[model samples]
Target: MSLELRSVNYPRRISLMRNNKSRLSGFTLWEVLVVLFLMGVLLTSFTPYYGSASKHVRLQMNRANIQRIEGAAQLYKIDVGTYPHSVTDLVYSQKGMSDWQGPYLNEIPSNPFNSEQSYQLDSSGRVNNSSAN
Candidate 1:
């Protein structure tokens, strides 16, 4: 008998075609590469701003440390009647000041910008310092 297989095969073939089209509907390789390049460009533009912000934060920390050291020195002077000859003297006993109450700071802090460089105090107890980096 002559059977009409055309109708049955046509519907299956159409469905298969539709599925293939749907699978291919997403982004192509060129489109994905373009998106990645744009993102790189956007991030690079903000790099300078991030660099300057970090430097500013380091400088602020150094200034705050100097202020703290100066305050502790002033307190030591008030109690003992003169500024200590060095920063360590603030945290340790000198010779014979029975009234000395100190260890003013738990420990000396190094410069934030340069760990190898310690803060300097002038006759006036100001911080003038250098950085290794």
Candidate 2:
């Protein structure tokens, strides 16, 4: 007599595997929204810090430009025996001032915080920003 073995049925096991795979395939809508919300919160928290940092940087740039103008003025005084009569004197030759050895500065820099304003020179030979208090 010959005997044959029967194949085992695994319908429940196959169905369970398919269900687990479908559930794990991707994130749910709520999960995605929660992640987006967290990212937005982080960005809002950093916005003010970045804005103030940019303002501080502009202020520092203006200060450096002022110092540069002051040094150029001092150089002009040493060469001409007088402080510059105006900011323009540093960049151009003045009438009857034969000792001037400039264009001291290539060009005057505008106030970093205010594009419409320019730096100023005081009678004491110091440079200042008129609009900055």
Quantify all predictions' global Cα lDDT against the true fold. 0.78, 0.83
Compute the lDDT of residue 131 as modeled in candidate 2. Answer: 45
Cα-based RMSD of candidate 1:
3.6
In candidate 2, which residue ranges exceed 4 Å CA deviation? 1-27
Query: lDDT score of model 1?
Result: 0.78
Overall local distance difference test of candidate 2: 0.83
lDDT string for model 1 (2-90, tens) is: 34688778899999999999989999899999999999999999999999999999888887788878898888877887776767776
Residue 90 alpha-carbon offset, candidate 1, angstroms: 3.0
Which candidate has the top score in TM-score? Answer: 1
lDDT of 2 by residue, 1-133 (tens): 1222222336666788999999999999999999999999999999999999999999899878888888999999889988887778899998888898998999977778888877778866797546442
What TM-score goes with each of the models? 0.74, 0.72
